[model samples]
Target chain A: MSETNELKVREKQEVAPSAELTKPGPVFTPHVDIFETDNSLTLLVDMPGVKADDLNVDLRDDILTLTGDAKPSLATPGEKIYGEYETGRYYRQFSLSEVIAQDKIDAKLSDGVLRLTLPKVEKATPRRIMVQVD
Target chain B: MIYRTLFGAPGRRFGASLKELEEMQQRMDRLFNGFRDRSAGRVGVGAGVFPAINISEDTGAYYVSAELPGVTSADLEINVTANQLTLAGERKISKEAADARYHRREREAGRFSRALALPGDIDADNVKAGLADGVLTITIPKAEKAKPRQITVQ
Candidate 1:
């Protein structure tokens, strides 16, 4: 929480078929699951068809951003018979809270889920103080 | 008939929100108002639940993809017939933590099934499926006659 107000997350609708999208092609906002544990916050994002090499997860100034560029898997040599689902890019961002240990963020991708774990700092955890009897 | 089914048995269904009723009222008003918005010619929308999908076609094959975040490959099942394709899957919720509480939950977990009628000339043997980043992509090759062919002038 800071003096400058910023939304924790924002989803841009870049794939409206009525030509409301400004980009050249469609770019979907990947859905994410954010779960808070005692020690860390786990984020699981879905970005199908996105290889590890094409994904970029960056953190700058407490703002964490995820960008993935996926090739058109539907662009096959065979002639088209029926179709649904377009191939496009993916983007998602989150404002990391100060209680997290920024340096120790861990990320993993498997079976289309991008898991990012942001561990809490020492100060954020609870501590016990012994009573002093005089 | 829809109105009768949704709200017809008024005493049976209770506690529906005013906003939802108002939206339904507006839809009813549009239906009975007798004024057609010819300018905005759009297809009728489907029931608002479940994932949304799109379909496209080419000369040689068919492509279909479904948005299934939080669903694993093992949870998915696909079936292809001579003129039909079926996708059925379930998204399971994690139960690892006994004391975990949610402040907000937007993602839903449930079983979803969608079926589409494929053209009769589908080559079922060459169908391929891949799941990545929560999306399911299926490629089905068309029959020999369905593929594009060219003729040369002598």
Candidate 2:
């Protein structure tokens, strides 16, 4: 019951609070997934409807920014469509911690998917030691 | 007589042959134009369409690669079912102020999904995925029977 109440509250908050209220401005938001492996941390971002030449990735002052644009589909006059997916530019930002290796980060974009590989610093990775017995 | 046999009647033969010849010419023109368009770099999903991918058996593991240019690792979802592999996610637009006007927008956006049928059955529990430089590389180790083995001779 409490959970349902909370969800209802959330839904209410998302709805417009009043009539004549201005619509919110467009936001630059991108969905991202992070995974960690033995060697590196990988990030995959989807930037569909975007071309390679229009993407930009940068890391500045511990903040990583990814920005790109997506082209809209061509619409003919008097054409009737029944979908509500909008294509536009994409923007996302991430604040990095000291644990991340800033200098060795690698990024690539292909087929509308962006991938980032961040290798851990030497001191951050686990080291195995061999023990010998006499 | 020949016209009657060719078109099922005498008067309609010329018209039918003319229409047939026009269609054949149109088809030939389309074929040539398609070749020319491809040579001009207009093939396979145009400028913003993502690349279609296929994974083949490589050594001891399954290799997966997808063409996702201008995308980073932060925007991907990969899942493996019993015998199917699914890649689904969205790419957002670049963030700018509300008043910014785009002159030439040509990137793909919104959600995209790709599913692959594995060549051989795999252990979904052990599947692994990696993304580097806009390419997603998934490595699925072959099952016990699927892996190559050497028999002993007595």
lDDT of each: 0.66, 0.57
Off by over 4 Å in 1: A1-12, A15-23, A73-87, A124-134, B1-51, B148-154
Query: Model 2 residue A27 lDDT?
Result: 31
| CA displacement after TM-score superposition, residue B25 of candidate 2 (Å) | 20
Q: Tell me, what's the RMSD of every candidate?
A: 13.8, 21.3
| CAPRI grade, predicted model 2 | incorrect
- Residue A34, model 2: Cα distance from true site in angstroms: 28
lDDT of 2 by residue, B1-154 (tens): 7765765665677787899999999999999997985464223332232334434465466765554555456777888987788877664555533543333233444656766677677778898876543445567776777776888998
Candidate 1 global lDDT: 0.66
Measured with C-alpha atoms, the lDDT of residue A3 in candidate 1 is 23
What TM-score is obtained by chain A of candidate 2?
0.60
The candidate 2 chain A region of ten consecutive residues with least summed lDDT is A4-13
DockQ of each two-chain model: 0.18, 0.05
Using TM-score, give the best candidate's number.
Answer: 1
